[model samples]
Target: MNVGSTSTGTDALAVLTRVSAGYGRNVPVVSGVDWALRRGEAWGVIGANGSGKTTLIRTLMGLLKPSEGECRVHRNIRFGYVKQRDGLHDLFPFTVREMVDMGRMRGRRLPSDRDDRMGQALETTGLVGIADMPVRELSGGQKQRVLIARALVSRPDVLVLDEPTNDMDVAGEQAILGLITRIRAETGCAVLMVSHLLHAVLQISEQLLIVHEGTVHTHARDEAVHKDLLSSRYGIPVTIRPGSGGGLSVEAIPGGGGGV
Candidate 1:
């Protein structure tokens, strides 16, 4: 892999140059990646289970260190991260407002603008009425929204979501996806999201990244390259076609199962 240089983009919010990440000093789970996330852009990452998608995001978030190369964020840039809701402690006694308020920790003090941002985040996620409700009382979908609201409280320049809609049903998935769109539209926040919802990813992303065997394949959303790359990476006869709603859809070819 090329594992491009460390030269930053003119307006990039973050840049990854020849970056590699893993649990310890062992063989890296993801390596040789070169990417840049520009302001107001949305990038979607997809890969099969164990392909290191979460590792890559965590590395970007500074939650994990890269074993080699650089993962650089714009100086002083704020990042908001929303992980899968499954990781939330349902038994936590915090109310919705208190939970979202945690996002303010990144700042020195609760400035007026930051306070307004937190209130707006809760209102934007439709959690205002339930602001005092215990997080344990919320449904799965509601909890996911609360998580998103918490992330938004920082008014971060870059937002990263790892499998935000993992366990939701179709309606829940659509709602979350729609909420993501609204967030980007309103805040113009650069978004890096890892999702299993192929069609929704296709609809929202400006760029698509497919991770396979710890490597990365990137393509513009409108590019045709993904069809072959995805099929080869997944070891399946994957097909990409237009859906009735003018979005792309991916499916495995029937009876064409065993891959090349």
Candidate 2:
């Protein structure tokens, strides 16, 4: 695949050039990938299980070093990440306000505008109504929103979500997806989502990183939603068409032995 030159997309927030990143065994999960996260862009990273999706994101986050090429991020660009699983102790009863406050930068003295930022984050996330609610009592969708609010309080330039809808039921999944779309539109923060929600991803993302057979292909939305590319890859019939909000809609054709 043509991973592109390092010098391209100089205005992007981050760029990965010919990057090969993985762990142990002298083997890389992904290699020779060129990815650029540009300003005000929403990106979707998708692939089958263990197809090196996480490796790519970690490489970009500086959690892993590229064994081959270079990964670069713009200076002073803050990243807010919502991992698929949070490490917080569930036994501890934390309020919504307290939980979001945890995202504030720790220093000798807190930022003078901390309260204002917290309020804005809560408002942006629709958490103002439940700002004092106990986190343990929240529904799945509400919990996800709290996580997003926590991240937003930091005013990050890049927001990364690792499978934001992985375990949700249909309602919860759609809620989170809608919230994500709204957040991107309102905040204009660059969103990088690592998700299994393929259709939802296609609906909201402007750029796509499709990892297939150890190769990462960068695609525009139009190129990424090809029926042949998806149907053949997933071993099922798939449907594709234009969606509301100027994006694409995809569906799996039913009655096949294996699902899409």
TM-score for each predicted model, relative to the true structure? 0.89, 0.84
RMSD of each: 3.4, 4.1
Tens digits of per-residue lDDT, candidate 2, 139-197, equal: 77788888888888888888998888777776777778788888888878999998655
State model 1's lDDT: 0.81
Model 1, range 60-95, lDDT digits (tens) per residue?
A: 877788888888776667788998888888766899
With a 3 Å backbone cut-off (N, CA, C), the pairs that clash in candidate 2 are none
Which residue pairs come into collision in candidate 1? Answer: none
- Model 2 Cα shift for residue 183 (angstroms): 2.0
- Compared with the true structure, all predictions reach lDDT values of 0.81, 0.78
